[model samples]
Target: MRTVRVELGARSYPIYVGEGLLPQVGERARQHLPGRRLMVISNPTVLGLYGTILLEGLRAAGWEVLLAEIPDGEEHKNLTTAAQLYDRAVSGRLERGDAILAFGGGVVGDVAGFVAATFMRGIAWGQVPTTLLAQVDASVGGKVGINHPQGKNLVGAFYQPRMVIADVSVLASLPGRELASGLAEVVKYGVIRDAAFFAWLEEWVEPVLSLESEALIHAVATSCAIKAEVVAADEQETGKRAILNFGHTVGHALESITNYSRFAHGEAVAIGMAVAARLARRLGLGFSQEEEERLLGLLQTIGLPTSVPPDLDPEALVQFMQRDKKVRGGRIVWVLPRRLGEVLLKEDVPLELLLEILSNQA
Candidate 1:
């Protein structure tokens, strides 16, 4: 197992990435999390697949494990579902000393972490991510929350998990589209942070996509390390951390405008990166067409969406972006790439430029 540490001093935690880590989740949780009564939150689909083994492991480890299944999907990640979880926790008589175990993908992690952050003022939570997207991005940083009516992740908090158990083996069972969705974030890490990693991806992406053990483990570990570094530097997103949202401005807007059913989170981000590329070229940010093609080509190779849905209204999309949490002084902060492995935050992008870019990309 490759262990990456998020060095937050008092809040420091470890992320374990490897094959066959699922079966060891209970033992790991016992080491990191401080609680007896554990609430394992997941979706029906995931629970149906690995629930029995996971529960048995936890019980064997002496955890008073309770199962709370949230209906799967991004749309269900809202206050209603959180309220239902709240009901379960109250009825379960869970106390502040207990913890929550996020047992599915990003949706499960976000809502469960939110509950842990707010339930009885706060509680501990750990992540057992089953999807590549969650393993590489969502499950690492402390960002947790549900979607609001206006924007994605608008109502969220920075609640870090105690430990993250990312089992790459679970990814082999993912649908083709879901696996492709994760590669989008994997590509993001290269674009915004490490040129060497990006170059490595150019050569090794195929093997990683094929679930070759070495490449998969390396991808997950490297992605987690980059995020861990970013999160450690700007835990509250007050500065450098915004770089982590390189493709998220338009990405989140796309998810909001489409009601989140048309595209997965990483797919929307893939399209967002595509749009950002054009925006960078238009603004003379030194991103050449060749570089744009290189980035888009990687996404295309992974079967990720690289263009905005033609049916989405540009104005409505802009309206949703205005509601994004990154907006500062009423100006939407955009994390646009200057080149592969580097990004710049710009809040001065004109409305006309944004509209024109969206129109062209669409």
Candidate 2:
């Protein structure tokens, strides 16, 4: 196993990435857990697949484990689901010293983390992320929350996990489409921070997508390392950390506009990145057509949609973006690309330019 540390001093945590790590979760988690009692939150689908092994591991470690199986999907990520989990925590006798383990994908992690953040005035928690997207991006960051009706992740907290175990073996069961969706965030990391990584992806992405053990481990570990560094530098997103939301501004707007029924989070982000690149070129931000094509081509090769859906209304999307958490004082803040592997957060973009770009796409 490979470990990446999110070095937040008092709040430091390790993200473990490798194959066959699922059965070792309890052993690793014991290092940070203060008590033997814990609850695991998972979706029905994931629980059926790996819950037995995880529960056995915890039980063998002398830990008492309780299970809370939530339904699968983004629509269930809300206050209602959180309340259900709260009931489970209370009935299961969870306490401040006890930990909550998020044992599924991004949705499960967000909801379970939120419960740990607010339950009995906060408690310890760990992550056992089962999906590539969650492993590479969501599980590493301390950010956890449910979607508000107004926007995505508007109701959440920066509650870091005690440990994160990302077992690449679990991804073997992932649907091809779901795996492709995750590549969007992987691509985002390359675009925003690592030019060399981006160049490497142009050749290595295929093998990674094919789930070759070495490539998959490297991709997950590197993505976690990049996110760990960013989160450590700007734990609360007060400055440089905002750059990590490279494709997320418009991406969240797309998800909200569709009520989160149309596209997965990473798929929406893929479209957002494509749109952002085009907009950057139009505004003379130095992104060349070749760069834009390369970006779009990579996304397409990974089976992600690189264009906005046909039926979305530009005006509605803009309205949703205005409600995004990143917006400050009613000004829409965009993380626009200057070139491959580099981006800047800008708030001075003219409304006319935004409208022109959105309208043209419509």
Candidate 3:
């Protein structure tokens, strides 16, 4: 097992990445979470698959566990769901010292974390992220929230978790599409900070996708380490942390425009990254044709879509982006790539260029 620590001083927490960590969830939780009272929040699908193992572990460790299951999917990630969880926590009598365990994917983590942040004005929570996207990205950052009608993740908080338990073994059950969705975030980490890692992915894509133990653990651990470093330096996204949203600005727009039903979050991000690369090329940014093809080809190889759906209205997409949280003072702030392993946050992208970029179907 490899551990990566997100150094947030008093809020510091460790992310444990390895295969077969699910059965040890109880022991790990006992170490970080205070008190014995706990609420395990997961979706119906995940609960059915691994809930018994997790519950058995906690019970064996002498901890009282309350199971709360929510419906799965991005559409269900809303204030309504969070409110329901708040009720569950209250009814379960979870005190400030008690902890909420998010035992599913990103949706579960976001909703449960938000509940822990708001319930009793703030309580402790931990993440047992089952999805690759969650394990590598969402589980560590503490950027928890629910999607609003206006936008994705508009209603959320920067509440850190007590610990993040990522059992890579759970990924064996993931559908191929779900696995590909996670590769998007993994690819983002490479583009934003690690050129060498990106190259390694190109060579070892097969093993990584197949979930070979060593490659999988290394990929998850490296991504988590990069995220941990960034979060520790800029916990609230005041400056440097914005780079973490490399493709999220446009990705979130696509999700909001489609109501999050048509495309998965990572799929939207894959398209967003493609569009961003094109925009960078148009503006004569430092990205090269070779780099663009490499990025797009890798995404296609991973079974991710690399273009916006032709049916969606481009103007509406632009409007949604303007409403993104990254927009500051009515200007969209984009994290455009300068090269592999480097990016810059630019707020002065021309509106005409953006509109053209979004409109171009090819």
CA lDDT of each prediction against the hidden true structure = 0.89, 0.87, 0.88
Q: Give every collision pair in model 3.
A: none
TM-score of 2: 0.93
Could you tell me which 10 consecutive residues in candidate 3 have the lowest summed lDDT? 322-331
Candidate 3 stretches greater than 4 Å from native? 323-328, 359-362
After superposing all C-alphas onto the true structure, candidate 2 shows an RMSD in angstroms of 2.1
lDDT of 3 by residue, 1-362 (tens): 99999999999999999988888889999999988989999998998899889899889988899888999888899988988888888787888888889999988999999999999888888999999999998898899999888656888899999999888899999998889989899999999999999999999899998899889998899999988988889998888998888888788888877867888889989988888888887788899999999999999999998877778888888877765544555567788889998888888878788777777743
- Per lDDT, what order, best first? 1, 3, 2
User: What ordering of candidates by TM-score runs from best to worst?
Assistant: 3, 2, 1
Clashes of each: 0, 0, 0
Candidate 3 — what's its lDDT?
Answer: 0.88
The number of residue pairs in model 2 that clash at the backbone is 0
TM-score, per-candidate, Cα-based? 0.92, 0.93, 0.93
lDDT for each residue of candidate 2 in 193-270, tens digit (9 for 90 to 100): 887888888889789888998889988898899888888889998888988888888888888788778888899999
Question: Which stretches in model 1 have alpha-carbon errors above 4 Å?
Answer: 149-151, 309-316, 319-328, 350-353
- Candidate 1 vs candidate 2: the TM-score winner is 2
